[model samples]
Target chain A: MTSSFTRLLVMVQKELLELVRSLKLLWVPLVFVLLGVMQPASMYYMPLILEKAGNITEGAVIEIPQPLGSEVLAQTLQQFGTLGLLVLVLVGMSSVSGERNSGAASLILVKPIAVFSFTASKWTALLLLAWGSLSAGYLASWYYTGLLFGDVQASKVLGSLLVFGLWLSFAMTLTLFFSTLLRSSAAAAFSTLGTAAALSLLAGLLPKKLGWLPGSLSSFAYQTAVSDIANVSLFGWALACTFTLMAAALTGASWLLRRSSAID
Target chain B: MYDNFDFGQILPIIAPILTIQLVLVIIALVMCIKAEQTRGPKWMWVLIILFVNLIGPITFFIFGRRNER
Candidate 1:
């Protein structure tokens, strides 16, 4: 058991090194920070931007009520839900399948490392990146929101971050699972994004019925930020479902990878 | 519209966005220069990373590299 733990640690280290070498560790979080900052900044400056770009007649009033700080932060999460999710999926889509397709997996699998360790390590590294980027972005958004608008409660910000981070973990885990199952990275990315879109769409369409779905985590995060969550039971269910799905996906990826490694 | 707005107030707010963008572009350029195998022509990626605003560097980071080695 100690040896296995050490192996897992080694695998995680290798994954982190690769991420750094590829500059993903630097760029992904930076992108998130940019996305986070842009939301509140643009919203704060909307009037000025519109005045400059729209070329309205002088003295033409464009009186738009300022959004609450929490609402602005919620909007930032919305941006993260869409474009931020896409970037993460794209970055992680090639985690396993790319190595396999390029024959790197065969090289590594011929050694003594366990396949479960390999998959678990990849999952861990991806989680680190996802959580790190999400936190940086969320914190930036919170700071900017406070600066530009008004103070949001620390509990609300932290609560929303945890909820949204779980949703992102679900997305990243799905990408990893698909990457292990499929040979093509593009297919893995497309399928993962498609599934996320469908899940969110379904939850949005039938919030009363599908509130427990993992897709509703984004909504939960947004609502938690803007005000008190409307349904505590539903949020709890969604949290449970997200954790279950993430674990299931990781396990599925490990099994698939073990089979594939054996075949190779 | 132009006279009433305080440049001092606005610059501080927008400065971080521009700084982050500049950092992204610089990092992308450095990586592009150092990368041995890009998905397409290196010169074209340089163009994209330089000209495409916020998305260009992200695009290069995601799709431009072959991800080998």
Candidate 2:
């Protein structure tokens, strides 16, 4: 008997191709890299540009916080984080719903391909894309920051990046779940944004004591990673919440497929 | 030592990693086409092989290899 599961491997290969070939594939990472580059590049040069402007409205000597030391980092993360998350959102939107729209799912199902493979491939593809793009962004951002600040604390940048990665996983999961629920790309994309936004607001309405909820943990990471906020238990809860959300999302997708299969 | 990233130096590493993916893509296409085994138009198979290279090949092997149900 063959030891390796050629089936699983092949399925993964298909997913990577789908992602790599799409025009959006190029655009998604391009925009993300732009976000990474633009943030630090723009911020580092901003003061010089402003100084050259010669104070046209010379009424007040306004002191804008120069992006030095931790400040460079603050600006970088804030700009990149927001843009990167949007990229993640668009990626999650495309993952399943795009497959649905393209009739790839229907075409593949008629063959021997298992539905589980369908689900797994999508998750793997998005995760890998996230990995590649995030790593690239981090490296670029680090270099840019080093140019301004002597050198940033690697531990701090790594810690904050890890936390951001975790939060992004949740956002992707929520988007994936919505995509599976609604086969339309527009519906999947908007529902994901609306759902995340709503849940965050809703989490705020609840007591600060319940900080481990998915919504709360997502926000907590920014302060904890960048600003030295503490609560080991919150991080623990954050991990737990992320796993639960992912499990729930995958479970929901699986259940949806099974039911649809049955109905057909 | 950690700050040793020369933009020129990094390009070589990034290049091979990316090129490796292309090789993998071609290998995947071959596998998908072979497993499919039919002599008819392979446009659908080609798309699956070319488009969704990672998952597409596997999907083709598991789902697309056999005649459609």
Candidate 3:
């Protein structure tokens, strides 16, 4: 048991080293910071931007309402949900499949490490990358939001950030699962995105019944941001569902890897 | 509108964004030039990395490199 734990740790180190070598460790967080900064900065400068645009008629005034700090922060979360999520999934889409395609999986599988350790290590590294990037980007956004707009309560920001982080982790796990299941990284990314879209769409349409789904996590995050905490029970359920689904995806990925170590 | 607004005020607000973009572009360009094997023509990637704003470097990072370790 101790040996397997050590093996998992070693694999995690290797995966993180790969991230640094690929420059993902640097660029991903920067992209996210850029994304975070863009939201508040653009919102703050919208009126000026409109004034500068060529289409405006003479003497015409554009009135834009400044958003509250919490609203701006929520908008940042939305940006992360769409573009930030895509960046993460694409970055992680090849975690298992890339190695398998290059015959690296076989080489590593010949070692004494268990398949669970291999999958768990990849999951840990990807999750760490996702969480780190999110925190960096979120905190950057929070600081800017506080600077340009009024300050939001730190407690609210922390709560919503945790929920949003879970959503991103769920997406990363999906990427890992599909990467393990398919040889094509592109396919894995597409399917993972499609599944997330479908889940969110369904949850949106049937909020009363499906509100506990991980798809509702972003909305819960937004709620935690914009209003007082009202439905603590529902948030707990959504958190539980997301955790269960992430565990299931990890297990499925490990199972798939164990079943077919060298699909390529 | 132009009378009251100061362009200089905006610079400090956006300085961080510009710095991050510059760093990304420079790093991506260096990597593109140094890479032994890219998915497409190296010159094209260099152009893409130079011209594409925030997206250029990211596209190059994700899809450009062919011989990843």
Candidate 4:
């Protein structure tokens, strides 16, 4: 067991080194920070933008109400949900399948490392990237929102970050699972994004029935940030479902990779 | 409200966003140039990254490269 743990750690280190070398460690989070700041900055300057771009006649009145800080933060999370999730999925889509397709996995698998450790390492690296980028983006949004709007409770900010991070985790895990199962990275990305979109749509259309679904994690995060009162029970269930799904996906990827490695 | 378009006040607020965006575009451009190969024409990616705002550079970054190792 100790040996396995050490193996996992060594694999994770290798994965992190690869991430840094590829410059994903830098660019992904930078993209997230940009997305995060855009929400609040655009919101704060919407009227000005409209005036300048729309060429509204002087004395023409525009009455867009200023959004609350929490709402601004929530909107930032929304940005992360869509474009941010897409970027992460694209970055991670090739995690396993790319290696296998390029014959890199065969080289590594011939070594003494366990397949579980390999999958676990990839999953951990992806998680670190996802969580790090999300947190940085969320914190930037919170800071800008506070500066431009009003103060939001730090507790609420942290709570929303936790929930939204879980949603991103599920997306990344789905990408990883598909990468392991499929030989083509593009197919893996497309399928994962499609599944995420469908799940999000279902959760949106049937909020009451699908409130506990992993897709609703984003909504839960939004509500937690924007409202003083949130449905804790639903949030709890969503959290539970997300973690369970993530675990299942990780194990499934390991199993699939083991079979693929054996075949190779 | 029209008078409130003070560049001094606005620049401070909007500067960080523009800077971040510029950095992203620059990074994407540098990568595109240095990349051994990309998915589409190199000129097309340069145009997209230069003109298409946030999503363009990101698209180029995520999907542009054929070989990312």
Candidate 5:
């Protein structure tokens, strides 16, 4: 376990380099930032654009507030929770498979790096990148909302940001694990995305609360921003995040073991 | 989000995060450069990955990692 931990650290460092060097890294954050910013800006300005259209017939007009802090959080999260998370999954799917394809995995393994460590490092790096992108999107949304809706305060959105960040990180872990199992990045990405979609669907179908599931964070975040729903304590969120991250790492380890035994 | 780089509020949060990201990204970039791949494949791959970002890496990873000798 200790050796695996060290390997995991090294894996994280190595995988991080591949992520930063690539074009996806640039676009992933840029897209998320754009998504987060667009949500509030679009919401805040929609009413004005609607009024200008004068398309409403003799009926009550709906007015959208100049983005409340809650609304900003809601809008940003609505898109980020879906699109941003998907992008993160896509980014993560390449963590192990990319190196393996490039023959980098073999090189790393040849250098006293255990396969599990290589897997762990990739998972960590991917999750870290995903977390960073999520934060950036959160930041952008906060700023855009602050400018568009002057009534609400920053403190209002903090809970939502934190929870969503943890959720995104957890999702990244799953993606990395699946990437290791799959023979191709495309397959891994599709599988992860499909799993995410399925999880969301499952959450929707299950009338009861599925704590720590895909949509819970978004729900928790949105509620904290709008209602008096107390912001979830960091402990629960941290535990879930760590659980999912570890799950991904362990799943990958099992896959490595399976492959090694199969080869033998 | 608070104020364009609100030193008091946002900096504390973002500073550590940014520092970690910079270090990680630098390392990831180095690993990518040093990594070996098949001749025709690596160059083609570099172009694809550079442009496609996550999509390319995911694709190459699942499908291409084994083809290299």
Candidate 6:
């Protein structure tokens, strides 16, 4: 047991080192930070932008009200949900298939490490990147929102960050699962993204029945950010579902990779 | 229109975005030049890394590299 744990650790370190060497560790967070920053900055300048673009009468005035701090932060969360999610999925799309294509997976599978540990290590490394990038981007956005739009409660920010990070983890686990299942990285990325979008859409379309789905975590996160009172029970259920889904995806990936490594 | 738009406040707010973009461009360019095999011609990637703003570097990172593990 101890040896397996150590193997997992070593694999995690290797995965993280690859991330660092590829410059993903640097650029992904920067891109997310840019996404985060754009929200409040663009919202702050919306009136000016409208004034510059819109053809108005001489005496017309732009009466758009400034967004509240919480709203700006929520907008940042939405940005993270879309473009940030895309960046993360793209970054991790090649984690398994790329190694397989390069014959690295075959070489690594010959070692004493268990396939579960191998997949777990990849999940761990990607989770670290996802959570780290999310925190950096959210905090930077929080700072800018505070700077430009006043301050949101720290508790709200922390709560929403945790909830949103779970949503991202759910999406990333799906990416890893697809990466292991499919040979083509583009197909893996597309399927993972399509699944996530469809799930979110379904949850949106039927909120009452599908409230416990992992996709609801995004809405729970938004509520945690902007609303004073959130549905605690719903959030708990969504959290539990997301955790289950992530665990299932990881196990499935490990199983698939274990069976297919020899073929690859 | 003679207006009271202060560039000073906006400068501090917007500078980081510009700086991050510049840094990404530079880093992507350097990596492209150093990489032994990229998906396309080196000169094309150099042009993309130089011309496109935020997306150029990211595209190069994702699709441009060959045999990245």
**Reference interface contacts recovered per candidate:** 0.80, 0.00, 0.80, 0.80, 0.00, 0.73
For each candidate, give its TM-score against the true structure: 0.97, 0.70, 0.97, 0.94, 0.68, 0.97
- Candidates' DockQ values? 0.71, 0.04, 0.72, 0.65, 0.06, 0.63
Candidate 4 residue lDDT tens string, A1-264? 999999899999999998897778888998899889888988888887898898788878989998899999998999999989989999999999888877889899999999999998999999999999999999988899999899999999998898889889899999999999988899999999999998898888998889888998888888889884367777778778888998998899998888767554
Question: How high is the lDDT of residue A84 in model 2?
Answer: 70
- Candidate 2 structure quality by residue, lDDT tens digits, A14-111: 87886665433554454455455556666654654565565657554546675554555555556554657665776577566566666666677677
Query: Per-residue lDDT tens digits of candidate 1, residues B1-69?
Result: 455878898899889989999999999999899989899999999999999998999999989987666
Ten residues in sequence with the least summed lDDT for candidate 5 chain A = A255-264
Which interface RMSD does candidate 6 score?
2.5
lDDT of 1: 0.92
Task: Estimate the overall C-alpha local distance difference test score of candidate 4.
Answer: 0.89
TM-score quality measure for candidate 2 = 0.70
Best-performing candidate as measured by DockQ: 3
The DockQ of predicted model 6 stands at: 0.63
Query: Candidates 1 and 4: which is better by DockQ?
Result: 1
Give the lDDT of residue A46 in candidate 4. Answer: 89
Please provide, for model 6 over B15-63, each residue's C-alpha lDDT reduced to its tens digit, 9 standing for 90 to 100.
Answer: 9989989988989999999999999799999999999878899999888
Query: lDDT (CA) for every model shown?
Result: 0.92, 0.63, 0.90, 0.89, 0.62, 0.90
DockQ class, candidate 1: medium
* Quality of model 6 by C-alpha lDDT: 0.90
* Clashes by residue pair, model 4: none
lDDT of 5 by residue, A153-179 (tens): 556666667766766766776677776
Residue-by-residue lDDT tens digits, candidate 3, B9-32: 889899999999999999999999
Over the true interface residues, superposed, what is the Cα RMSD of model 3? 1.8
lDDT of 5 at A227: 70
